[model samples]
Target: MTTLLTPDELEAALRTIGAERYHNLHPFHKALHGGRLTRGQIQAWALNRYYYQASIPAKDATLLARLPTPELRREWRRRLIDHDGTEPGTGGVARWLKLTEGLGLDTAYVQSLDGLLPGTRFAVDAYVHFVRDKSVLEAIASSLTELFSPTIISERVSGMLRNYSFITEETLAYFAPRLTQAPQDSAFALAYVKEHARTVEQQQAVINALKFKCGVLWSMLDELDYAYVAPGHIPPGSFRPQDDR
Candidate 1:
């Protein structure tokens, strides 16, 4: 059987999970931000990550649909607009495409999502389902990964700019908004979890939810590393390195 923890203890446990399991610690991330990746590796990173970026609005909408009150729904609706945009050529998804375009990936094929690794789709989809099926508290808790996102974003933007001549600030602008948005969203999520998780069981569930989310993010990178880096197994029909082309 599991025991409930006090709110402060719960917070500490969540931090511990971030310290140990966050994608920032993954070797693929280290290679990415450390400038060790080839151009093909960078492309693989962006292509896989598009799956994660594209799914955010759908998952946010699912949570919004589940909210009981108009106020919460209104607050959550901003996330959808932020990702999907008020119009074309705007918002997070479009900005992400800019990153892909800058990387020389064809916008049509990228948007088609026909180029994604199988594991990338599976992991990102699992995150959306987690948000939909869990308690509201746990759903909100899962987003706390954003609490840890700003640092990784910083590392990615700075590292790419310094190491890769092909990368430009405009290409990386997708992260600029995320730097602000993630902290704002995470603050709300963290506070929500801290306040609503009154019992130990609820608090533990929130902690577990964050851990599960970290695994989701981490697993995507693992898949990328395995398929793009180690043996460089380019899955059938997926993007292949120029040398392989």
Candidate 2:
């Protein structure tokens, strides 16, 4: 913690965090991607995930307002446009709605977030608040999860298509753009963190920020696994899969 890491060492450390802590390693992810989940379970996953997806613009906006330079703000601005789009039926959030629609959930119900798991709400809200409250370097570092996303997404789209009768290429169209978008976004974040995280303390902060982001993502899945997989404790007032009902 005292030695300043060279950029390579820091990048390696960040990648190590992704390898160790990312949610793609979760059992629920394994089951979902391996096609072991029932339709109802998938429904629960998609429904719960909608809140996180829809919140990306707001999260980006919080950081955007805080970015100190025109360049940084402009770069961050693209993320908002990517998620929110210039019009309805465009961008990542709308595409995510396509995913839920394909899964047969009512879009209104998904957007209402009334059935959102408390853990999901808390975890995602913490992420937004992290962006809003953290140092700019830490805020950007928190988005380092994007570095690990393409792999999980590939597994998900292919796995869901192969296993689920209802899942179609169009259902997961949201991820297709992300295959490119995530890398670009993460590349910028990684470079920015490496360039600016100069002190040992700052480097550690970046590492912790990524760990926190990973924890947020991991915790969301934990909520899903608990409600849908393990002791199957569907918390009160949360969405109930027909299986659980």
Candidate 3:
């Protein structure tokens, strides 16, 4: 028989899942933060990651659109604003471009996503589907990855700065705001899960939701590592770094 845990216990289990499975611990990230990747590898990482960043506001909006309450919609709209920005050539996507541009990739190619990995597309699209198809609680729980993002962001920023002469503070501007925003967003989502997940079943669902999301992120990196680093198989019609050969 399966064991049911208290809300506090479930929260601890979720945190443990993150500690164990989150992408921060992935070898690719270790290579990235440890300055082991080449410029081409870094560029490949950024280009592939753009898809994830671009999809965030849309996923958030999809969840917001399903929200029945004006208060919830109003709260979620800020995430859209944060990613979409108030004007042209701003916000997270644009800032991500800055990183790509700093790395010498053409903005058009990166934005056009001409070189995206098949696995990257599949994993991110699954996230969108999860938000659309799942309950509001599960949708919100999927974003609990944000709870662990700040740590990765901090390591990436500091390590990249020290390691890559081509990288600049401006290139990393996207992560700066997220440092504060992620915690604020995750705290609310966590508290909501704890409060609303009154039943053992609901609580278990929330835990599963988080684990599923962690898998989503992990799968993305695994794709990148396989396609770009290990097997080095650049799939047909995907972006190929100049030095890939």
Candidate 4:
């Protein structure tokens, strides 16, 4: 925007962006949650998503290093801990592996990222690079998507549980913590952006940062839908869901 917005107005604008651009609105997400996706499609989703989950601590650590104060650093540190946990076999990333294993994917294969779609790698890497390279304001702004995540988590957990027999609550445990974590994380980010992004240029940059993150997420799903949902476009060497049989 060319004009300076009040904090509430800026928050409204950010929420408006979420309402319009969040990946929860993506067609692939719709199918996945609505039970329209096949086992293979779901496997591909879980497999590709592992890359994003695994990279989150790296993303948070980049931004955490840039924070100016102990408070900010401590706040962001919780994110690192959240994803990495105090030790192995704990944290969000490990929980995500459990999810992939629940989908019958081998833990080593998911960790190796051997079958990751190029699109997944590109989009997720772009997100990390964005955090590493951008202004701290923009970096913080990108995380505003967390504001909208809880609702989608609710939809996803409920829908998947009801529709898919293979997907039990235990399999989806990763999301349980995220329902609370996302709101807390986004509340901090939302306040930070509203307070820090005071000028027109800064405000617009924040808006654009959120839009960029949304695009990153949306693009990942787009690749999944194109490669898996739309028929035979799975890229060469990407995971081929039980083709051995």
- Please estimate how well model 3 matches the true structure, expressed as its whole-model Cα lDDT: 0.87
- Per-residue lDDT, model 4, residue 231, is 62
Q: Regarding TM-score, does 3 or 4 come out ahead?
A: 4
TM-score of each: 0.95, 0.98, 0.96, 0.98
How accurate locally, in lDDT, is each candidate? 0.87, 0.93, 0.87, 0.93
Model 4 RMSD to the real structure? 1.4
By lDDT: ranked, best first: 2, 4, 3, 1
Measured on C-alpha atoms, candidate 1 has an lDDT of: 0.87
Candidates 2 and 3 compared by lDDT, better number = 2
**Deviation from truth (RMSD, Å), model 3:** 1.6
By summed lDDT, which 10 consecutive residues of candidate 2 come out lowest?
236-245
Cα RMSDs of all predictions? 1.7, 1.3, 1.6, 1.4
Q: Candidate 2: list runs displaced more than 4 Å.
A: 243-245
Model 3, runs deviating above 4 Å? 1-4, 243-245
* Candidate 2 colliding pairs, count: 0
Candidate 4 residue lDDT tens string, 22-121: 9999999999999897787898999999999999999999999898999999999999999999987999999999999998898999999999999999
Off by over 4 Å in 1: 1-4, 243-245
Report backbone clashes per prediction.
Answer: 1, 0, 1, 0
Which lDDT tens digits does candidate 2 get at residues 1-245? 89999999999999999999999999999999898888888989999999999888999999999998999999999999899989989999999999989888888999999889999999999999999998999999999999999999999989889988888999998999999999999999999999999999999999999999999999999999999885689999999876531
